[model samples]
Target: MKRSLPYLLLVVPYLLLPAVVQGQSKVRIACVGNSITFGHGLPNRTQNSYPGQLQKLLGDRYEVMNFGVSSKTVIRSVDNAYTTTSAYREALASKPDLVFIKLGTNDSRLPYRLKIDEFIPDYRQLIQSFKSLPTHPRIVLLLPVASFLTDTTRQTEQAISSLIIPRIRQVAFEEKCALIDLHALTIDHPDYFPDKLHPDSLGASVIARRLHEAVTSEEVKGFDFFAAIPQPASISSFYGYDCADFTLAGRACKVVKPRFAANGLPWIWRARFWGHEPQTDIALLDRGFHLVYCDVAELFGNAQAVAAWNTFYRFATKAGLAPKVALEGLSRGGVYSYNWAAENPEKVACIYADAPVLDLKSWPGGKGKGKGSPADWVIFKNDYGLISEEQALAFAGNPMDKVAEIVKGGYPMLHVVGDADDVVPVDENTAPFEQKVKALGGQIQVIHKPGIGHHPHSLPNPAPIVDFILKATKP
Candidate 1:
């Protein structure tokens, strides 16, 4: 049927429009912050800033604008207040669907620290200002990265820890805004910050990856970990078995390819002890399960440590390994295993923890019956930004606190503990944890060795462990 020219033109254009144009709309994201957002000190400021990287990561469906001014502060009373900046006005004018606030690093400066009392109210006001906008953006508060500067007077990590972050947390809670813990993300990674303040290119990439994960509710997978391994790296040989020594996210990593690849290339993610317990790894290698490890020693499975593991997981999975991994933790490695598993429940197949330090309070904090390491305790507290023993006691992010999530994910856990262990006693660490898991209706198997201390992690034969792993990770 012939139609009128004007009507036919309109109808044809509408019908011929691309599916994308007719479907979901683009998300407008306004990245509002200071020098960090401004991409200062970054070589390729236009392309390598967190916002710029976020745009690439988000692809065509998102418009991530970098509206950041150098030396800007959330506090209006500060010498260079973000409220007075043109970037602030531009951010408001952009009418973004999402706004990420990464201020307060500059506010922690000595001059602005004096007016720190005004921070909460000022931050609240700023948040309200965004809320009042017609767009009513979904605001996310980013806790600032830790300062690496030795001069405590000018820009102190203590100021951010003691004054800024607590207030930021309160603001997010009160305002019902999402919070991304950048502080924890960058805490143990001092190498990320080249100038002791600004993040280098790699550091910015990490931040962008984290932000993308938060927004999309998806993990950044398929990183080529082996590609990042430096040239001329030495392969460690154990009894004619060769393992490639590589680096993932600047951390030491080892990959032992299986004799035969499983259907999905199912691998065992050794949380720690790359070479300590050869029996289990060798057995797994014989069974076509690739053995992998990324060193995260002394981190105690804090947010930073978990983040590193998350990166490693992505890299390994992308490198043709299985999407789900069987976690093996021996002694203190238990902390890394359970914590990483808890954070990423769906990615884990099962867990095997031997003589594990399930709770930091037992082996590290010394809050319980076990004899703790004083030096390690200090490091633990500092890694997590724990100011007092009371805070450490009250902290609930431990593996013990994550039983519900683990159960919900349907991940069965196995623990090997020593009954007479004093360093990390079963009575203090594994016993109570197992009880809680069972009480919560979670699947947990415990193998207790009597008259054994914390030493001699993993099984001598490893046949039983291998059997369990095979069953758990069966394709």
Candidate 2:
């Protein structure tokens, strides 16, 4: 009976082990950084930290641990170095499957900024330390949120923009680690950051959502675009493609071509939103379309910008790309896209403008029903050689002025605009523009996203936008 009892005990334990082990199998994620990750000012640190929010979003499958230390710098030479902390050691020992490092905010401080040169090496070392762990975690480097402080000499936006971020990007590239751009994510939403540094509960949620998207999507951060076009002297590889960075008539010009051209060589002329909200372009690239842009920023689609586009167009066409291309403009990009299409109607296939400033007067000039950029207004005036504010106010050469030319060309147009857009109000831009186009027998489709603003440029699923471009540019 004693021998039977021992066998029974062993068999019972073995029979129950599989279920317990299966239940325990959760992907461990270590959130390693400073106060931001620590949920410093949040009312409830346990539930409102980005790591905490991330766990909720990821459900029961992910065990996210906040290994954050307050005011710690990634730069090892700095006084409060993150590497010296217990959290650092624990993070390494945890055998985490994934690690999110958000440590550059403290490094942006003026005291730490002096040791800027040490940033890259130290960051690389940190990434390597995680990579060397037995767990072999996938490390993601997060660019810190923009400092809203106007002060330049201290830990301000200038320090972040000039010193920390560029180096961080370079380190991410050098280490071949994925990067999640928190800077771009929260730059517009200053309201989210009550302290202008540490995000509140709402801001933490935003960070968690973006992190979830970046992590779960398994997107190769800074992917190399395959280049099938002739490499220009100024061109380099950007996210896995051949990219040309040169000045067209002394203005910044960029061209990104895919590794394989779609049938008939379809391409998109990105009037604006070059770096911001690139999902549409990413989708188009997947469908075999080349993405190209010329920085007509502050030009407001003036004659100079048109000339630059003409030069770019000739260069692009001569390089064996399709003659007619789709135009993608977001916000101010609408002016460049529509103005260029109006001037050279024969070269355009379709136009997709999102919350676009079709009328410059509605935006920079502050002439109409929108809050305008006084600084950009000066640039807009200078670009057109306007001698006075009165001249700018009376200027008749806006995109709306060229509606006849655009409509005459039989080009299809799509506008994904916010009904609540006050910056480039639909009443001043798309509403009037659509009415004119339709009255003149032009084909235009408007997708009005309710309760949205100019901030979010594209739909969650860019399929409809991509479908429009594909159908318009079809051979």
Candidate 3:
């Protein structure tokens, strides 16, 4: 089954919030204002509302309340002044410990546009009212989400950005309150706002996730770092950065974010080994590069592997990774990397293969100088759907058969080989590939480790490899 649009990217899970919190018995969170907070266009309002989704992420330790009234405004003179609403009174009486105020899009309307001068005072009054509560809740002002409308129904993105958000920012600064820039978050995805006014469930989920990040990230280091995936993943320390283990498209996946993100969010997509010889990954991460892996074990760079990587690539790029990804393949990983790169050559920035199995016939097929694994050969034959050894030998789908396509991508290739590798000899793998690439006017570099087999994958000092990747990645 193929997924498209909203169904494709939405992997939200209705998870149970943790029951215990450190200081508070149950920290009350008040979600104040508008249709988005109330989840107007969502398929399931109760479950998919921003506040409802936020409750699931924050856990049972926090009580999230929704006091949102559709088409309400902070300006009292507007058509529906939020202060006059019963939800506002109820919110004031709820005694919240934290308040998130999101009320401005409605104010960007025609009738309300004239009375917008009163917005600041009303907004400040609203904040003071919340602060005056017995709990003295910490108020967080949210800039209005970008509106794609320009008609009389709703104001345009320009109106919201120039007329509304700047006022909200001023209110945040004047009141000494924290702020979440929802405009900046939603501006990129107009598709999230189908109606140009209300966000659907997927958009609501995005808001909730961003809220989760802003609200809890500072206090909790390991909180659901990649909630874009279905469930909360285990976030263990990876070189003092966050390495999340999760599943993408039913394949086990791992993503390690850089300590400090560099411009363009450049990333390296590693194949095969998740943790073996991680120097190159770590060095790249140190220089602000995201490291990712999607397990295509049985697929083995076949069409299915290409499809899985296609989804992964879309997911990564949508999440703000660079368009072109660096490929890292170690030993058999070479098969996964090169085969996929061959299929989608333009998607690759560069290829770094270490003692890779360029031709499976050389290793698993054991039809060459290297000692072959009969079991793996059987598995490979089955995966490729080859009926016989003759058919397998006749297979023309290997990376060795993809030199023209890979070189046509116009990206450089780097190979690290052990000259004495008997498992997948350098001559049978990287050497031949390099020769083909060079003959065809392509850039290919090979670093040979003499008297070394395929035991160690990368250099102890990964400077050369790191330098090569950084240079390739640079604009």
Q: Whose lDDT is greatest here?
A: 3
Candidate 1: misplaced stretches above 4 Å?
A: 1-232
> Please, what are the lDDT tens digits per residue for candidate 1 over residues 1-475?
1111111111121012122443536777899999999899998898999999999998987889999899889999867999998889999988777789999988888788889889988999999988898776777788888788878776678888888887886676566665666776676678999888899988899889878855664111222234434565666543223468876678888876542344445788888776785667765654446788888887889888999999887767655566788999887789899888888888988998888887888878777777699999889888889999888888787787887877777878888777888898898888889998999898889987778888777666465676788789876
lDDT of 3 at 357: 91
How would you encode candidate 2's per-residue C-alpha lDDT over 161-200 as one tens digit per residue?
A: 7888778767865666655667766776789888788899
Candidate 3, residues 342-456: lDDT per residue as tens digits? 7787789999988999888897888889889999988888888998889999988889999898888899988898888999988888888899999999998999899999878
| Candidate achieving the largest TM-score | 2
Looking at candidate 2, the ten consecutive residues that score lowest on lDDT are 1-10
Candidate 1's C-alpha lDDT? 0.77
> Would you list the rank order by lDDT, best first?
3, 2, 1
For model 3 the local lDDT of residue 472 reads 91
Candidate 2 vs candidate 3: the lDDT winner is: 3
lDDT of 3 at 250: 88
Residue pairs with colliding backbones in model 3 are: 17-59
